[model samples]
Target: MNLNGTAALVTGAGRRIGRVIALALAERGADIIVHCYQSRADAEETAGQVNRLGRRAMVLSADQRDWNAVESLCRQAWDTFGGIEVLVNSAAVYRRTPLGDIAESDWDEMLDTDLKGPFAFARFLGPRMKERGCGKIISISDTAARMIWPGYIPYCVAKAGVDAMTRGLARALAPEVQVNAIAAGTVLWPDGFDAHQQEQALGHVPLRRAGSPADIARAVCFLVEHGDYITGAVLPVDGGRHLEG
Candidate 1:
């Protein structure tokens, strides 16, 4: 993957880690398709940053939980950019649902957005990339999938599914499209976390520090550019937190 002048689509790219990934790709000279569900203003801002980097950019909105919307997103990206050479499935939702209070809707939302959404994107765009005989797909997974998280069963399960999807898609689309994942840990503290909670979270990491979005972005860049022989790998960008257990 040369990355230069390639077309890349990053879901949930309106903000947070996704935004960083989109900007990093654009910095490497890839045209960006910034996908968002509700953060249109943020998505537009990301597109502006990409353009300022001297790369082409387009903002597209789609509900990843909707199969039809996912399909439509692929179609629109292809229609606008001819074809996407890189697909980064970064869209996801996280919620703290304790076991006793878990609802059916909570499970559905978690699995649909975090797991099925990436699967749908890969399912639809994979064959086309296969026909072209070269492409890259990276899913954003989580370290929680590899460890037990008391109040986030649904999120953990969904990310585990993403790990499985990455391996399965790698084999299914092998010899052409490479599929991989980034299992991150404590990269960005979510809103509502108090200083004490944040400290407790960081305490588990062997590095004794939190990771930045740029850390994940750099891993994405490596997979997109230098990882020619790498596929089906779930690289951990967790600052050694996964090593704790």
Candidate 2:
């Protein structure tokens, strides 16, 4: 689908990859609905950038894990732009939940924020897109879902859930809207990742380096602007890390 003049909803657009994706879509001539959980200031900044790019932009905040909040978020998105032609589920939390230190709350937060949150948005928005007869849904998944990185069991599980949800939604949304995932690997290292940890992470990457957010951003553009025949697929923008194992 052509991105020109359409509207895109990008979750977690306050910072990081989500921010990059938002700007990229704006550059493609799409207005942006920036969603943030607690980063309104940053989201506003992102919206300003979009405006500067000559595209309409707005900031909305919501708790992705809350059904009511998600429902309201969707309402505002449509009401503001008439309709959202693209939905990018980029809001997620990543944390280390080691085997022994893992707690119930850890599981809840990871699953709720990382897995259920994205699903809730897609579940609430996918049908509407289907009704419109055209749309694109892309979730930012992780290669860790395939590798099952140690010390991050919950994160891995949540990303695995994202992969599953992507496929399921693609089928559910059918020929109208394309649903897919981009499984990233080591694009942005988390805080507190020591040099040793970073080294270990890159050791598994055949490209021997981490990726930049632009890589993922470009892939998103391709799926949104050029992937008319693609759906239910997880495209890896991991610099070949997913191929290591």
Candidate 3:
């Protein structure tokens, strides 16, 4: 996919890694649609950055829990940009749902945002892109899915589902739209991680260091802009974290 002049919708692009991915795509000449739920202000800031890079930008807000949100987002993106050639599922929820005390709401939030939400976007846009001839869909998964954490069972499960869905979508959208995922490592510490926990987590990685948001962003760029022959693959951008086990 030629990112030049292409339109991409990056969900959860309000801040953090999502913001970085949005900027990276814009810098490469792709216009961005910054999606956010509570971070509308941050998303607007991201859109401004994209415009300063000489690429067009738009801000769209939607709750990932709702099924209608994806349809609305795709419809507006098509109307505004004529068509979106790329889709990035960067929005996610990472909550600690330990066993024995897990609530149903916790499971709902994690699966809805991390798994179902991204799947909805791809399912809605995959065929559209295939019809248009070519497209790319990239989701931000996590290494924890492979090495599940005791305290984040729901998060790990949702991310695992993302990997599974990535493979499924790849075959479903084959011949034109490429569907893939980036299983991120310890790029940024989750909100509640203590220093000790962070250190313990990094110890498993051979590199023994945390990766930056740009690391994942670059992987996203490679998948969308340079990965013509790649699909259904979950590329790990985790400082060798996944390789440890």
Per-residue alpha-carbon lDDT of model 1 for 1-245, expressed as tens digits?
89887999999999999999999999998999999999999999999999999999999999999999999988999889999999999999997999999999999999999999999889999989999989999998999999859899999999999999999999999989999999998988888999999999998999999999999999999999998899999999999889987
Looking at model 3, the pairs that clash are none
Candidate 2 C-alpha lDDT tens digits along 99-180: 9999999999999999999998888889999998999999999998998888898999999999999999999999999999
**Winner on TM-score (1 vs 3):** 1
Q: Pairing residues by index, what is the TM-score of model 2?
A: 0.98
My TM-score estimates for the predictions, one after another, are 0.99, 0.98, 0.98
The TM-score ranking, best first, is 1, 2, 3
**Which segments of candidate 3 are over 4 A away from where they belong?**
none
lDDT score of model 2? 0.93
Q: Which residue pairs in model 1 clash with each other? A: none
RMSD in angstroms, candidate 3?
A: 0.9
Error of 1 at 64 (Å): 0.5
Q: What are the runs in model 1 whose C-alpha is more than 4 Å off?
A: none
